[model samples]
Target: MSDPVQLATARELAAAGSVRDTLLVGQRGGYAVRFKIGAGERTLVTKSGSPRLFTGIDAAARVLGGLGIARYRVDSSGLAEEDLPRRRRPDRAVALKRTHENAAYLEFLQQRAEAGRRDTVRYTDEQVNERMRTLRTGRRA
Candidate 1:
């Protein structure tokens, strides 16, 4: 394995028609591109030196098309769909339900408040205070 080729360098080689025998190899969860430049086969790598991975074949094809690579062989022998990592979010559904429930309760409270404001009968602060005094002493205040 020669030194991995950076994406920019791969693009340059691809544009210049120096890249050959391009292959799209499928991994457990993604696809990677490998191609021959001169006599050495190189894998495309990111700036951090990790093989650049595309989560889907469509994305990989779009990128390859942008790099002027019109043709490539696909090998899906390594792609085990069942072996791909599954992301579990059991709490997410509960949290979303709680959020919606809370929103509905708040809307109910707001509607009740608006209905209270629209009532024909209203009480002033003094009347409310006198009513409280009468209720406390069992007599008119």
Candidate 2:
């Protein structure tokens, strides 16, 4: 059915002010509704001037549909995943391109590191050995 007519029907079914509240009130995950009953999750839906406990949103929807209060019924057990369009996997060409890009970046970093080490100041053999020992042990030689 059309959106506007369907929304109006849903609002009347839930006794809510707006369409958003109607959907919120009809929390269909477990098919349960949160209408004002007492003070908790349990809510009362009046039928024929008598207050009745609505067991599930599906049942409420059925009653509303039977009474022409709702334009359509929602399937509680339907998988939302089925409604989504299938996603295409990236081909081998794209995967290989990404790997090549990563390898090139690593080679650039390696070259920069080697250049940094080569540009470092040179010291005497004995001083170099002492510096290496200090660096390896993280302490004075």
Candidate 3:
């Protein structure tokens, strides 16, 4: 067994009751004191959405096999945890609902416009009188 790596950061984090969020980065005695002893601990310690459990070597293997940790270092360029490519959108139910709503609104607008045009035939008496006056003035009827 080796010495527990003097992780000041981890120690500080553990001291601050951030044990749920922190991980010992180096070896602790013989086993790595990483988040690999329990599933709950692993999930809590891992970068969000990674599948690697806190089971040490097995979890490390999974990490190597495309199960990413999404780690980054301040000094380095950092790793690119590429998203697993898949279909853009599987569900069009909302879009279809919107389309139907738009169509209904459009139909209502069209009907209202048609009704307005039809109603214009029943002009006011003042407008009829004005038209007659214009005709009497020898304007193009």
TM-scores, all candidates, are 0.59, 0.23, 0.25
Question: Between 1 and 3, whose lDDT is larger?
Answer: 1
For all predictions, the C-alpha RMSD in Å is: 5.1, 16.5, 14.6
The best candidate by lDDT is 1
Q: Can you write out model 2's per-residue Cα lDDT over 1-141, one digit (the tens) per residue?
A: 111233234346456423222221323233333322223222223334223323455666665555344543334454343443344667877999999999999999999999989986877999999978889898644
Better of 2 and 3 by TM-score: 3
Q: Where is the poorest 10-residue window by lDDT in model 3?
A: 72-81
Put down candidate 3 lDDT per residue, 2-76, tens digits, no spaces: 222233433444445444432323222111234322234432222343322322344443433332333311211
**Candidate 1 lDDT for residue 17:** 89
Better of 1 and 2 by lDDT: 1
How accurate locally, in lDDT, is each candidate? 0.86, 0.47, 0.42
Clashing pairs in 1: none
Segments in model 3 whose C-alpha atoms lie over 4 Å from true places? 1-87, 93-119, 123-141
Give lDDT: candidate 1, residue 43.
94
lDDT rank order: 1, 2, 3
lDDT for predicted candidate 2 compared with the true structure: 0.47
